[model samples]
Target: MAANNLRGQVLSLYSRLLRMSRNWNATNPAETIVERQYIKEETMELFRKNKHHSEPFIIKECLKEAEARMTMAEHYRNPYPRPVNLPKRSFSKKEGKKIGKAIQKFNEQSRPIYIRSTDDAVGRSS
Candidate 1:
């Protein structure tokens, strides 16, 4: 029953993504065609490639990724994927280089730290 629900969710998300791609329009006239094509092609290719997976966890993860991408696209008004790493030019300045080294050290040293509110930590009540 849960599997059937997950399948339905995936199909619904896929349909919405396709509709979004078909209707995509960029603010820049020159980019509308390119961005629209990219959205459509990427959506179709990824959905087709992952259609064989029967695992609910994997499907949920994929759905989460698709939803996040849609939210980001709408928020940023751009459909292109974000870059995983900063461009080399970003580290060309002395300050930038220092910041880059700090980031690298942090990445190598530990897991991300999540800060909680003092009220939560102390279990405070009004």
Candidate 2:
């Protein structure tokens, strides 16, 4: 759970940095390029460190973001191919049904705690 939180923090920071770069580009074109490059390098380094620990969704997002940014940085490099093909795995119907039931059971057990935590978070944030 602690590791997941840390990974979330890193992902949030990366997203913020990307937004800042886009904003900078619009307002300060000359400075934006340099700043963007610096941010890209820093983000790449941080991402590499946490890559193995990243969740599936985050890893996908990171790869997509990196490819987009790299294409922008190196225009001469051929445009990235559409529909990056990630490897797929298959499971039997029995396995799927078992997994679904397990998830449902877990959610049913944790729903109250999850709601309380969410309420607490909202109350604190506000």
lDDT agreement with native, every candidate: 0.66, 0.46
Give the top-scoring candidate (TM-score).
1
Worst 10 residues of 1 by lDDT: 110-119
Off by over 4 Å in 2: 25-29, 50-126
Model 1, CA-based lDDT: 0.66
Residues 1-126 of candidate 2: C-alpha lDDT, one tens digit per residue: 755665675667578656655544423455657666665665556465546644555554444545454454345332222232222432223643555665444443443321221233222111
- For model 1, residues 10-74, the per-residue Cα lDDT tens digits are 88988998889888889898998888888888888777766877888767766766787788788
CA RMSD per model (angstroms):
12.6, 13.8
